[model samples]
Target: MSTTTMKYAVTDSLMMLRRSMLHIARYPSMTLPLIIGPIVFLFLFVYVFGGTLGAGLDGSSGGRADYVNYVTPGILLLTVAGAATATAVSVATDMTQGIVARFRTMSIFRPSLLTGHVLGSVIQTLLSVAVVLGVAVAIGFRPNANPAEWLAAVGILTMLIFAITWVAVIMGLVSDTVETASNLPMLLMLLPFFGSGFVPTDSMPGWLAAIAENQPFTPVMETLRGLLMGTEMGNSPWIAMAWCAGITAAAFAGSVALLNREPGR
Candidate 1:
């Protein structure tokens, strides 16, 4: 792209991002569920099921504190899932509400509309992650990660959020209605449970264990757990980033193509 064009794109994306932030501020209801849902899961698992679940780990004395450490990575991913779902709904709303059609008729950079949503979702998701992490710490979740490890953890999370936000954008693009957009991304929420979110893969039967061990979220969760708790990381960190990069590339291309295909999809 030319320098002039690049500048225009940046300017337009920033304006759209500001619009998204304002919408978030006005409709605080949309963002609250993203924070509250994860917190509820954190509290529910820690207080109600922690003892028994802690005992099921390879080593533990069946304590809530032990489970708090074990379950935190999964809860964090849940926060990301919630944010992605919300992004889909937001994007779909814009698509169906005639705003996208109106934007297309204007002189602004076209891709900036989607760019704003992706960037805004990433920023909002990170904030939600921080809030959930704070609550986790308050409820006895502790991480031994140093400053560098904490930074690395945040880096991976940002990558994951960016990638998934694009995926959500595509979900919104193809959706005919806002309800379908919301429902389509619900699978993202279920991925963690099917992975290593709630229980160890070995704790499952052979077939189910295999599914948990191989899925995308499992490596990401394992990477987070290893970074935080000093567990065995093996190749999980690299594997997780590879998944994020692949997803980001594919989803970014798909979202842009979908937007460019139809004027008001």
Candidate 2:
């Protein structure tokens, strides 16, 4: 791209980003569920199911604390899943409200619309993750990671959110209704349960465990577990990053293609 075009794209994307942020501020209700869902699960699992689950992990009577540590990473990933749903709904809302069609008529960089959604969702997702992490710490979830590990955790998280948000943008782009967009990302929410979010793959049946072991969420969860709690990560971090890269590239291409073909664009 030429420098002038690049500059224009950046300017338009920033404007779109500001617009997205304002929309979020005005409709904070859209974000509340994303934050609340993980918290409810955290409390539900820790207080109600922690003892039995924790005991299974370490064979101790006071296993609730251990369970808290094991479960927090999954809950953190859940927060990102919730962000995906919110992004999809936001995009769908824009499409249905005729705002996207309106934008296409303007001379602004066309990609800026989706770019704004991705950037805004990243900011929102990270803030939501921080809030959830604080709650986890309050409820006996502890991390022994140094500054570098903490930074790595944040980096992986941001990458995952960025990748997932692009996928959500595509979901939003294709969805005919806001409700459909909200529901489309529901599968992401179940990923942790199917993988190693709430429990270990070894504990699952062989067939189920195999599926869980190979899925995206397990590696990401394992990476987080290692970073935060000093658990053994092995190749999980690299695997997780690879998944993020692949997903982002595919989703970005799909989103751009969809936008190009969009009616009235």
Segments of candidate 1 deviating more than 4 angstroms: 263-265
Superposed Cα deviation of residue 210, candidate 1 (Å): 2.0
Task: At residue 47, give the lDDT of candidate 2.
Answer: 95
Mind giving the per-residue lDDT tens digits that candidate 2 earns over 145-221? 99999999999998899889999999999998999998999988889899999988999999999999998889999
Runs of candidate 2 exceeding 4 Å displacement: 58-62
Error of 1 at 264 (Å): 7.7
Report the C-alpha displacement of residue 118, candidate 1, in angstroms. 0.8
lDDT of candidate 1 over 7-76, digit per residue (tens): 9999999999999988888988989999999999999999999988988888777688899999999999
The per-prediction CA RMSD against the true structure, in angstroms, equals: 1.2, 1.4
lDDT for 17 in candidate 2 is 96
TM-score of each: 0.97, 0.97
* Local distance difference test, candidate 1: 0.92
